[model samples]
Target: MATEGIEAVFIETHNWGKSVKFFQGLGYQLEFETDHNSGQLRNGDGPTLFIAEVPADRETPLQLVLKVADADAFEPGDGVEVVTPFEDTHFGTRLATVRDPDGRLWNLQAPAEDRS
Candidate 1:
């Protein structure tokens, strides 16, 4: 596995305020928040947490973010299926999705390539 381990956990919640509070209660510090009720939190040297607000009717599952050196150069080995190709995210990172053998989807994150 070329992955650099977990970078962050992507969490979707209908109650953004509650969710943010819950994580904060766990000792996570708010790093920065967006105007759209989404924010990132960090707890020491552990992986960061990204909380995003979603519609109540939306059924988004929690996703683990795997860090990679380069999203465009990532390779899904063996039984891993590529769910989504690497793409630019609104948060200024490159993201890709892959499904493991157990049918769980994971997000691969990498620093955005300098297009300059």
Candidate 2:
């Protein structure tokens, strides 16, 4: 419940290249990129977006990262299902994932030094 506003969102695309290009036309630039699959884009300090290509049949969704005070304390409720428990991330953060009632997944995260 104690989280900052959403910091980023990942929108899985069946055609990752096209999505990236489309956003590029709108002035978004690559923030972090990987040739393997996914990349993040940013427009100033506003929320960044990550795009990735995945099989169309894959049921898993892209994530929406909500900055939280403590990812470990975020319990599942209000029609939400905890899919992954909080774990230390390589990017200096604590993270967990959950699915909302509408089937949208959200990634609960906290900065490394905030509260792991």
Candidate 3:
């Protein structure tokens, strides 16, 4: 099936506090923050923004997260490169990585299957 749309934007920054304030200044509200300098923010009906802090020595690129109803139902048609298969995430979702024609990477996220 086709991807639903962008679900969220994943951002990694060296300065977590500054990044959070930057987005807040742009009208995004902090939804929930983790103890480890990570959090989710939202602005009206727009996609959520998930921010994480990384070490200054680490280089992390911004990522756009796509939504899929079910990971098992996703199809990567010809010309679509699947860099990794969907796997369970600690935050409670199944995520996969794919590369576009221009070599930029995007993340695909699906609701986690029921564990019960």
lDDT of 1 by residue, 1-116 (tens): 48999999988989889998999899999999999999999999999999999998998679889999987777778788899998999879999889888888888999998999
Residue runs of model 3 more than 4 Å from their true location after superposition: none
The lDDT values for all models are: 0.90, 0.79, 0.94
Model 1 gets an lDDT of 0.90
Q: What's the residue-level lDDT of 106 in candidate 1? A: 88
lDDT tens string, model 3, 34-54?
Answer: 999999999999899999999
> Taking the candidates one at a time, how many backbone clashes does each contain?
0, 0, 0
What CA root-mean-square deviation does each model show from the true structure? Answer: 1.6, 3.5, 1.2
Worst 10 residues of 1 by lDDT: 71-80
- Give TM per candidate: 0.88, 0.71, 0.93
The residue-by-residue lDDT of candidate 2 on 34-69, one tens digit each, is 876788899888878978888988754666788777
The candidate scoring highest on TM-score is 3
